[model samples]
Target: MIERFYLKEFLTFKEADLEFHPGLVVFTGPSGSGKSILMRSILASVGLDSVEAQICESSVTWMIDEERYGLQNESLNTFRHVKKEKTRYFINNQSTSKSSMESISSTYLRHLSLKDYSDFDPSAILKIIDERISARSPQYAGILENHRVKFAEFKILSDQLRSIEEKEKHLSELKEFALYEIGKIDAIKPTVGEDEELNLIKKQLSKKEKIETVIAQAQGIFSFESHVSSALGMLEVDSAFFDDAMNELHSIIESSLERMEELEEVSVESVLDRIEQISELKRRYGSVEEALEYRKQKALELESYETMEHSKSDLIKQISAIKAILETSAKELSLKRHAILGETLEKLNGYLGMLYLREATLNLEPCELNASGEDKAVLGLAGTKLDKLSSGEFNRLRLALLALGVESMNGGGGVLMLDEIDANLSGEESMSVAKVLRHLSSRYQIFVISHQPQLTSMGQQHFLIYKDDESRVRELDDAERIDEIARIISGDSVSEEARGFARDLFERARGL
Candidate 1:
C-alpha cells in the first residue's frame, strides 16, 4: 500500500502531497479538475505510466523478499520518478531501470481501471480459483502444484514423442543413407599418412635414372682404385692407408648402387596413382585420418539407426507410465477444483448481487488438461457474455471479483486505483460499489475518483482536486468535506438541500 504520494510541477497542479490510509482513499472533484492527471502522476512514479512532470514520488510498505527483488532487509521502499527529456525511475533512492521498478511495484500495487482484462486472464482466473481452493484445504495447494509440475512434464514428453515419431517415419531411409556413406569410405580403405609416404616414394622413383647413372660413375672410381694402389706401392709409402681408403670408398659406392637397385623395382605410375587416391580422400574428408574417422562415425550412426526401434519402444513405455500419472493428477486436480468451484461462484455472485447485478450465472467447467488446469471458468450476466456488458456493469463486475479475492490473496494485498468508478452508476449502485470497496479496504489500499457523493462521503481519507486559477489538491476537513460532497451532489452550486443531504450522508457513514 502506498503510505504517501507527491506530485510536483505536473500539468495544472504545481505541487501536491497526500498521505494515504488503509481503506478507500477517494479523490472527488468536478470533471476536468485534474483528478485523472493526479492519478496518472502517481502511476508514473511507480513506472506504470508516462507523465510530463518534474517529480513524482511514492512511499510503500510491504514484506520484502530479499531473494526475489535483490532488496535488503527493509520493508519500506520509496519510489521516485523524474521526467525531463527522458523519464528516470528509482527505488529506495538507488538508480534503477523502469522495468525493474515496475516489477517490484507490481507485487503490492494493482492499478485496476474499468477496462483491465488482467482479472479475466486464464492464469489469473485459475489463480483465484486455486486461492479459494487452498483456503478451504491446505492439501490442495500441494496437489495443485504437483499437478502443474506433472502437466509441464507431460507437455515436454509429448513434444519429444512427437519429434521422435516424426523422425522415425523416415527411419529406414536414414539407416540406408548411413550405410551407404560408410560403404563409400570403407571402399577407399584409407590409412593415416599414406599420402605422404606415397609422395616420398614417387619423388625417389622420379630421381631413379639419375641415381643409377651416378652409381655407375662411382663404380668406375672404384675400378681406378686398384691402379692408384699400384702406383702408391712403387712409392713404397702408405700403400696400406691407400688400400683402407679405397675399401671405404668401395663400401660407400656399393651402398649407393644398392639403393639404385631398390628404386628400379618401384613403379612411378603406381606411386603416382596411390598418391592421387589418397589426395582424393583428403579432398573429400579433409585428411586420410579424418576420412577414417568419418567412416567410424557413420558406422556408429548406422548402429543407432538399427537400434531405433528398441529405443522408440522404451520411450513409449516411459511415456505411457507418465501418461498414467498425468491422467490421475489432472483428474484429481479437476475434481478438487470442481468441488470448491461452486463455493467460489456463490461468493462471486454474492458480490455481484451486492453490486446490484441480479441475474448472473457463473460456472467453472472441466476442460482437457493444459498448463493452467483441467477447467475453464465462464461468466454470464442475464444470458449475455460478461464482456459484452456495459462499462458500468463491467466495472462493477470487476469490483465484485476483487472483493471475492481479497481474503484469499496471498500477499499483504495491493493498492487498487479506480478512476471514476461511480460516474455512470445510479445512486444506489454507487452506494453499493462504495460499500464493496469499503469491505475490500480491509485487504487493499483503494484509490477511487468519484463524482458520487456516497463514495466521496465513504472515504477513509478524502482529498478534493480543484482548479481555481491553477489545479490544487487538499484534504477535506469534516466541514470542508460537507462543502465538497454538497458541491459534488449539486454540481457548481451547492444549495441548502444539497448541504443537508451531504451532512446526512456523512453522518450516516460515520454511524456505520
Candidate 2:
C-alpha cells in the first residue's frame, strides 16, 4: 500500500504532498484539473510510469525482494524518481535502474487498466481455478496434493531410468573398457618390495668387475695374516691381538667374495627390464600399490555392472506403479476442477454482467502432467485476448476476475491503480463497478480517478484536485466531499437537489 506520495515540478502542478490509506482512494475534480497528472506522478514514484516531475516519491508498506535486489526491508520503503540531468530511480536510498525498480514494484503494484497481462497468465488462471475448485470440493485439495507428490517422485525416477537406458546403449563398451584397464595392470605382475631389491642388484652389477678386482687384491692381506702372527710371537708382543686382527680380516674377505659370486648369477638385462616396468607403473598410478588398488576398484565396478540390470528392472517396476497411481489421481483432480469450473465461470460472468460487460469463457485444456495436474486454464474474453481489449473493457474484465478472487484471497492482495474506471458508464453500471471495487478493496488498495458521482462517493479516502493559480489537491472533509460529489453530479454549478443526492450516496456507500 502506498502510505504517502509527493510530487513536484510536474505540468500544472507545482507541488503536492498527500497521505494515503488502503481501500478505494478516489481523486475527483473538473475536467483538465490534473487528476491524471497526479496519478502518473504517483506511478512514476514507484517506476510504474514515466513522468517529468523533478521529484516524485512514495512511501510504501511493501517489502523489497532483498535476496534478488539486495535492499534491506524497512517498516516503510521510499521509492523515488528524480529528474536532474537525467531520470534516476532509488529504492530505500539505494540506486537502481528503472527496469529493476519496476520489476520489484510490479510484484506488489498492478495497473489494472494498463496492458499488463499478469492476471491472465496461464499459471495465474490455473491457480485461481484451483482455488475455486478447492472451495466447492473438500476432497479436491487432497487429491491435488497427492498428485503433486507422486508426479514429483515419478519425474525423478523417470529421469534416472532414462539415464540408465542411455548408458545401456554403450554398456558393452564400458564393460570392455573396465576389463582392458584391469588386464593392462595385471600384465605387469609387479610386487611392492620386488622393485627395491632389484634396484640393489642392479647397483651391484654396475660395479661388479671393479669390486671383484678389489676383493682379489685384498685376499693377499689375509695370506700375510699368519706371517704377522709369527712376527708378533718372536717379539713376544701381543701375539693374541695379532691373531684376532687376522681373523677379522679373513671374515671380511670371505663375505666380500661371496657377495661378488651372488652378483655374477644376477641377469642385468632382466633387472633393467623389471625396473622399467615398475617405473611405468609409478608414473601412471604414483606407485605399484596404487595400481593394484585401482585394479581392485575396477574389478568391483565390473561386478556391479554385471548386476545392474536387476536394479534397473526394480526401478522400472517402482516407476510403473507410481506412474499408474499418479495418473489416476491427476485425472480425478482434473475431473473435480472441470466439475467446479462452471460455478467459477458463473460467478465471473455475474460480476461482468453487473459491470455491463459480456460473458468470459474459461478453457480447461489438457496438458502434460505437472505439479498443477493435467489442466491448463485459459480465460478468454469473448474471443478477444486480454492485452488486445480496449482500456474500459479490459479493466471491467479485470474487476470481474478480482471479484471472483475475493472469496479465496486471504488478506490484502496488493495495490491496484485504475484511471477513470467509471468513465462513460451509466449510473447503474458505475454503481455496480463501485460496489465490486469496494468488495475488492478489502483485498486491495485501489486508486481511481472518477468523473462520476457513483464511484466518487465510494472512496474511503477522497481528495479534491482543483487548479486556481496552480493545480493543488487537498483531502476533503465530509461536507467538502459532499460538495465535490455534488459538483460531479450537477456540473460547474452545484444544485441543491444534487447536494442532497450526493449526501445520500455518500452515506449509502459507507453503509455498504
Q: In terms of lDDT, which candidate is strongest?
A: 2
Candidate 2 lDDT by residue in tens digits, 320-371: 9997897788788778778878988898899999888878899899988788
Quality of model 1 by C-alpha lDDT = 0.82
Give all candidates' CA lDDT scores: 0.82, 0.88
Which residue segments of model 2 deviate by more than 4 Å?
135-143, 159-315, 378-389
Per-residue lDDT of 324 in model 2: 85
Alpha-carbon shift of residue 238 in model 2 (angstroms): 35
lDDT by residue (363-383, candidate 1, tens digit) is 677777776666787666776
List CA RMSD, all candidates.
Answer: 6.8, 7.9
Q: How high a TM-score does candidate 2 get?
A: 0.69
Candidate 1: stretches off by over 4 Å:
62-74, 121-123, 176-304, 371-373, 492-496
CA lDDT, candidate 1, residue 406: 84
